[model samples]
Every structure is written in structure tokens, then in C-alpha cells.
Target: MNIIEKHLAKAADLEKVSVGEDIRCKVRLVVAHDVTGPMAVEQFAKIKIEEVFDPQRVVMVIDHIYPASTVQARNMHWILKDFTKRYGTILYEHGQGVVHQIISENHAQNYGDIIIGADSHTCTAGGYGVIGIGVGSTEVAAAMATGTIDLEVPEVVEVNLTGSFKPFVTAKDLVLTLIGRFGTDGLTDKAILFTGPGVRGLSKDERMTVSNMGIEMGAMISFFADEDKDEGVAQTVAIELSEIIPVVACPYSPANIKPVQEVAGTEVTQVVAGSCTNGRLSDMKAIAEVLRGKHIHPDVNMIVIPASARVYEEMEKHDYCKVIRDAGAVLLNPGCGPCFGAHQGLAADRDVVVSTTNRNFPGRMGSREAKIYLASPVTAAKAAVHGRFVDPREPSGGGEN
Candidate 1:
């Protein structure tokens, strides 16, 4: 077997490995949010299971309904609270952070292990060298009961990203470029392995952004760097703290990846600079630094949403929030809101929107006629300030100052 097959074999072994083995495969991490936890609880109760395999291994978060967008969602939150409390599950409240952001930062993922969640982006954990996938409530409940879930091993595709991205071009752009090149259906059911020196240059958050959107390409998961080669099969991948750099995905496809100097003629209707994809502090800081004294153009409506309340707090603490607001951008709460068109940053028919969120499928952000362009936070910020897609390397103030 090749590198990917070896990793998959290790992931499979995790289900039956002894607790004391150098490989920690039997241990599993289960995650759920308010939107999916209630259903998971209901399913588990129907199976007549009184307790989960282990409460400490389960993580429940309440960011989906923190301010309670609706009465039904609020009720769901309450049910989640009760359910998690009843099982002594690890519960992360609004202040603890968003599930995705926390999971990436908390050092919870073990290489060669299987991590499952109710959210599709659960695949984001692949950045850490784990075999992560999203499942339905019933599947989640089953995993909770038996401590294992069935999955078909997927074929792996090597996505070799070469050359350094110019400033303002982010991981978001890289993935979006993939979508444009592959047409969102090209890599269906495949495991995308991001390789090459460019892939190694991205930060954990940027890798998360790339892996998180693998679903958009109809991929089973997007993985970065081979962890098995770097550490013991049971060990976790050690992130290089010094090599981390802020990145964003731009709107073009891989075939159309151009230096920032070449995108000076593109036009845009809206510019959004936040989402689970690129809404972290580093992402925001990159945009703020680029848009520092500049104001958003009057023609374009710029929306900036933090990934979580904790991220919001950090931004405010560091004055990045003030910098964004001063630049005439509208800030939104941290949720899957606008990313899915449920609420916030909705667009009109035929309106073009440039966003940092994952997925740009038809009607993803709002109307079917709305055209969604995905890019990095810097590109989005610079576009919002100019009412068009101006390359970040270009001088601010609608081109030349």
C-alpha cells in the first residue's frame, strides 16, 4: 500500500486497538452542535442506550443558537444542554468558542484515529492527520452506542499546489479555484490530499479552510501533509508554530490562478470577509492590515463576521474589530448564518457576492440568481473598499492614491 492506504489502514485499526497500544485507535472523538445534538439524543434514546461509550470523548457546543435565532432553535439548545448534562459530556458554551475553531486549537485530534461529527465540515480535522467525516444523527447515535461507525474507504487524489500565492490570495481562493476548475463535482467521493510546498506553507487554520470545503467538491475529505510519515501512527501531528501564515482563498479556479497583479479588472457587487472558512483572528488581522486607513466603497456592501465569540473577543481585545468597523464593514455574529443563506448577508437575484465562506453553489448565499465568488479575506477586504475586485498588491483608493 502507498502512503494514503497506510494511513487508512491505521485509521481502520484504531477501532480494535488496545487502549495501551502505542497506537490509540479504539478511542474516538464525537462532536455535535445544538442543531444536531437534539436529534442525536432522540435517536440514542430510541436505541434504549442509557449512556455513551464515554462522556469525556464527546464534545457538545452551543454556538448555533447562542443568542437564539428562533424559538425552535432555542428549544433545541435547551434539549442539548439537558442531554449533555445528563451524560456528563464535555459542553462548550458560547464563550468557550465555536466547535470548529476550538477543535483545531484544543489539540484534541490524534493522528491515524477516526473523528466523527454531525457537521459536514467535521472533515476539517483532516488537517491534523485524522480520518474525520460527518454523519447523520442516526449514525452519530450508533457510533455513540457501539463506539464505531462504518465507512467506505475512499480513493485519494493528490492536489499539488505549486508556487507561492501572491499577497491577498488565500487558501480560500485556492479551494475556490479548485471548485471552478473541477466544477464542484469533479472529485466526487474522493479523498483530496493537498501536497506540494505550497500546501506545507499554509497555517492550520488555512488548512482547515481547505479541508473544510472538501465537501463542496463532493470529496469525502481533504487532508494535508502525511502525519504518519512525521510521527508515530498513534501520535499527533506537530504543527510548526513559526511557519504559520495567514491565507485566504480567492474567487478564481485553479486553472485561473493569477498573480494579484493580474486581477485588476475584475468587478464585484459585494465583499464578505468572514465565515467558518476565514473568520479567525489571523484572517481578520490580515484584512485589517490591508484595509487599515481605507474605507469600504459606497457601492459595495461589506460584511465581516467572526468565526466565534472567542474570536470576536480576541479581535476586539487587539483592536482589529475597531479597525474593521472603522473601515465601514458591517460585523455579524459567529454562526453558519450567511454561509448557508439561513440569514445574514443575504443577496438578491443576479447580485454578485465575493465571500470567504465555503461553497459557492447556486443559491448558496441567497437567491439562485446571485453569483458567489470565493476569495481570501484580504481580497474580500480590498474588493469591499473599492467596489470591485482589485488585486491587493495594487495601491488602495480605487487603484492609485
Candidate 2:
């Protein structure tokens, strides 16, 4: 059995599991944020159960609209707080960071653990070699009610990598390259197991960046494996890491990918460098490297958000916050505010933004008239400096790595 099967087998307490097989497995953790947690708590109430299946295994986060953007949001937060308080489940409040990053850093402790989140980007835990599944609030309610959930084992797609990445060619670039090759729905209902020697070079944060975008390509999960195997594999896609360059997902779809050079000089009004995808300490360091001792373009507004309080502390220790502020960028607290378009630095009409977030759909960050280009932190930082798209590997506009 491969990695996915191994996890399923362990969770099911079965000797083996097969692709397409239906099984009920014990879940190690169930996560939901402010947006989804209230709905799930409401659903769980319908089950008529007095207590959650296991309070320790459940976590609720207040991230998407931290500080409550509206009366409705405030009430929703109240629901989550009341539910967790009544059920004794863990609650992560405002400034804790995005749910996915919180889970990866705090709850996901063991390899091959079966983790579930209400948001699709939960696959971010795949960086820890865990089977992270993104399901709806109803599924979360069921999982919370019984401590178990049903699943159809998915086929595995092996992303075989060769060679090493060039400077400024990050894991975000690699995943964008994969999405470009596979199209948005090409890997629907499948799992991706990254393999080959090149995987050895990537850091845990980089792996999380790659896995976080797996949902964009319709993958069930994306994770790293010790080695490549043909048994129980559905297909294999090979990638040459050295050949990859910084790329972006154009507005309207993650699949609308183009090399950064192809879009050079396209004016951007805003730049963002944080999310569950690329809002780690290393990502901050990368952005700081580009903006240090230099100010961003006078016309552009750059918003830098750290993913969590812990990452924020690390950035402060390293003086990354000072570097970013000196570069004329605005710093916001850790949360899912701007990335989800709920609050904080929302793009105005006709705004063009270069961001490090995972998605680029219309109105994702603000007005439908706004356009967003999704790129790595390095690429986003470069755009902030020049107020336009510029290849991060080139010689102009602090592009040199």
C-alpha cells in the first residue's frame, strides 16, 4: 500500500485498503474556522447530541473575519464561542492566524494522521505527511458527532520531481506550474504524492505552499512520500524543478497561469504577501529581502500580513516588520481578512493586485472589477517595489535573487 492507503488502513484499523473502497475511519482532528464553525455547530445541534464526540479532537478558529466585520459576523463568533465553551472544544481566537496554518503548526503532530477541516485548503497539513481532507460543514458535524467519517479511497497521482529549484523559484511556482500543466479539474478526486530526489530539497513551509494549492487542481490531498512506487498508483506527472520560473495565476482562475515575464510591466495598484499559503516566517524573510532598504512604488499599496502570532513574533525578532514598514508597506495582524475579501485593505474598483494568496477568482479580494495575480512572495514583493509585474529572477527592480 502507498502513503494514502497506509493512512486509511491505520485509521480504519484494517490491514489494507484499496482505491475506490468505501470505509469509515476514525479522524484524528476536525477543524473549522469562524466562517464554517458556526454552521457546523448549528448542524451538530440538530443531531440532538448533548456533547461532542471528543472535545480534544475538535478545534474552532476565528480567522476569516477577525474582530467581526458585521453584526452577523459577531453573532456567528458568539455561536462558535458558545459551542466550544459548552462542548469544551479548543478555540483559536482572533490574531491566532489562518486556520490551515494554525492546524499545521499546532495540531498536526503525527505523520499519516487523518485530519479534516471545513475549508478546502486544509490540505495544507499534507506538508506534515498527514492525510488532510477538506469537507463541508455537514461532514464536519458528522465527524464531530461520531468521531469518524466515511470516505471513498482516492487514486494517487505521483508528481515525480527531478533537479533543483533555481533562486527565487519557490514551491508556489512549482505548484503553479503543475496547475498550468494539469488544468483546474484535471486531478479531480485524486491524491497527489510528490516523489523523487527533488522533494528532498524543499522545506516544510514550501511543501505546505504546494499542498495548499492542491485543491485548486481538484486533488483530494497533496503530500510528500519517501519514494516513488507503481503499486496502487493511478498516474505519474514529472516536473523539472530547475526549469521552473516564477509564475502567476491570472485573474478569474488558478489555471490561468502565465510566466511572470510574459506579464511584465502590467500595472498593479496593490500587493499582498500573506495567507495560509505563503505567510510563514520564511515567506516574510523572502519578502523582506526584496523590500529592505528600499521603498515600494509610491503609487502602490502593499499589505503584509503574518499568518500567525508565532510567525509575527519571529518576524519581529528578525526585524522583518521594520524592514517592511520602512518600505512603505502596511502591516496587518494575523488573520484571513484581506485574502478572503471580508476586511482589511480590500481592493477598490479596477484595482490590480499581485498577491501571494492561493486563489485569484473574480471579487475574491474585493470588487468584481478588481483583478488579482497570484504569485510567490518574492514575485509579489517585486511587483510591490515596481508597482507592476516584473520577473523576480531578472536584473531590474530588485528582481535579482
Candidate 3:
């Protein structure tokens, strides 16, 4: 069994579970942030539960509307502050970073631990060999109160990667290719367990990117196998990194992927190179490599947000911050910026943005008339310097790496 299956079975005190069986399993962590936190607290209130089963295991992140967008958002932050203090739950303040990145980077490090969050992208924690499950607010409240949640055992799909990434290619490229080939709903009701020799070569940040976007393919969850994992057999597929490029998911749908070259020259209004999906230090280094000495187009407004306060400090210390600023990209304090229509980078009518964030549903980031193309950090950075859709491998943005 994969880590997810093993954790679930052990939690439920079952020897094993068949693929479709519904099992009530223990939740090691009940993670929620500002956008979903208030609703979860309300649900927990409905249950008349004054204290969580394990306050230490509950994490509250004030990320989504952090820096407090509206007065209502400010009030929401206060509620979370009170709840965390009342329950002694771990509270991550605004400017810390996106919840998914924060947990995977700091809190959710134990292998085989089941960390469930109210937000869908919580599955990003699965990259660390934990079973990261994203659940609804009601389920989150129930888990907080009872220390357990029920879930149907999902079909496990083994994705085998078997090649090294070429220069300018990052894990985001591979994920984009997967979503493009499978469409947005291809992996519905399934859990993906990535294994094979190639999988081990990816950095932790890269693996996180893969798991982070699993939901783009409608997957129940996705995780990387342990480095020493020895599973017998299961349904599987293979992908070679040599076949991938700095591709992008075109306007409206994450599944509507197209080659960067195909969309080359398409005008862009902005380029974002951060978010849970591609906001790690490695991602910053990748974009900086492409933007080493070139200034972004005057017409383009480029934003780069580190995944966490720690990451931001690392960038500043290493001068990655200086490099990006020198390249004419504005680096914001660590937070989720315009990834989900929050703030810091809204779009206008007919605006076109090349971003490293996940999900490109219509009206996701801004105006319904605006468009978003999902790509890797370097790809988006390259486009920022060019002010249009262009492959990072191309020569349009200053000199090549």
C-alpha cells in the first residue's frame, strides 16, 4: 500500500481497505486558513464543541486576505485570532505565506502523517510523503472535534517519471503537461502516487508543485512515494521529462494547455511568479536565472512573491530579491497575491496575465474578460521581460542561460 492507504488503514484500525471502501480515519492535523477558517469555526460552534480534540494538531493560517483587504476581512482575522488563542491552536499570521506552502515547509513534515485542510490546495503537503487531504469546512470542523474524518478509499494511480529535466524545464512544466494531456477532470476520484527513478531526482519544491496541482486534474489527492518505498504493484503510467517544455495552460482552463511557442507574441498585461504552486526558493532562482540582467518590459507589471517569510528572508539574504528587482520585477511580501482574486495583482478587461499560480478558470484571478495562462516561474518571468507569451527557451528575453 502507498503511504496514504497505509495511514488510512492504520488510523481506522483496519488490516486493509479495498479500493472503494469508506473508512473513518484519524486526522493528525486539522488545517484551515482565513478564507475557510471562519466557516469552519462556525461549524465547530454548531457542534457546541468548546475545545478541539488536539489543539496542537489544529493549524489556523491567516493568509488569503492577509494584510486585510476589506473591513470584513479584518473582522475575519480577529475571529481566527480569538479561536486560535481559545483553543491553543497554531496560528500563522498574514504575510507568512500561503497555508499549503507554510505547512509543507514548516509544520507538516512527518512522514505518513495525515494532514487535512479546509482549502483544496492543502494536498500540496503530500509532497513530503504525508497524506494531505483537502476537505470541506464541515468535515474540517468534524475532524477538529472528533479527531477523525471519513473518506472513500480512492483508486491509486502510480505515475512513473523516468527522465531528468532539461535546462529551463521545471516541475511546473511536467504538471502542466499532465493536466493538458488528461484534461481537467481526468483523475477524478483517484489518488496519484508518483514513483520511479525520475521522481527522486526532483527537489522538494519541485515535488510540491506536482502535488499542489493534482487538483487541477480533479484528483482526490496526490503525493510522492518515499525515497525507500517498496510497493508491489498497481495501476500506473509513465512520463518522461525530456518530452516537456515550458508550456502554459491557456485562458479559462488548466486543461487547455498549449505550447508556449504557439501562444508566443500574444500580448500580456502582467506576469506573476509566485503562489503555492511555484513560489519556492528554487522557483525564484529559476526565474532569476532567466532574468539575470534583463529588465522586464515597461508595459508589463511583474510580481514575485516568496512562498513564506523565511523564503523571503532567504531570497533577500542571497540577493535573489535584488536580482529580481534589478530585472524590473516587483517582489511583494510573502503572501498569496492575486492567485485567487484576493489582491496585489488584479486584472482589468481584456487583460492577459502569465502566472505561475495553479488553476486558470475563467474569472479566477480577476475580470471575466481578463485571461490567465498558467506556466512555470521562468516561463512567466520570460514573458514578463518580453511582454508577451514566449518560451523561456527562446531568445526574446535578454540573453539565454
| Residue 83 accuracy (lDDT) in model 1 | 83
lDDT of 3 at 285: 84
| Candidate 1 residue runs with Cα over 4 Å from true position | 14-27, 227-269, 396-401
How do the predictions measure up, each by TM-score?
0.82, 0.98, 0.96
| Arranged by lDDT, best first | 2, 3, 1
Task: Please report, as a residue range, the 10-residue window in candidate 3 with the lowest summed lDDT.
Answer: 226-235
| Candidate number achieving the greatest lDDT relative to the actual structure | 2
Error of 1 at 316 (Å): 2.9
After superposition on all CA atoms, what RMSD does each candidate show versus the true structure?
5.9, 1.1, 1.6
Best by TM-score: 2
After superposing candidate 3, which stretches have Cα over 4 Å from the reference? 227-234, 397-399
Judge candidate 3 against the unseen true structure and give its global Cα lDDT, from 0 to 1. Answer: 0.85
Give the Å shift of residue 37 in candidate 3.
Answer: 0.3
Write model 3 residue lDDT over 259-362, tens digit each, in one string.
88889889988998888999998998888877887889899999998888988888878878888999888888788888999788898877898899998887
Give one digit per residue, the lDDT tens place, for model 2 in 158-218.
9888889998789999999899888899899999999888888889999899999999999
Worst 10 residues of 1 by lDDT: 230-239
Tell me the lDDT of candidate 2: 0.89
Per-structure clash totals for the candidates: 14, 0, 0
Model 2 scores worst on lDDT over the 10 consecutive residues at 224-233
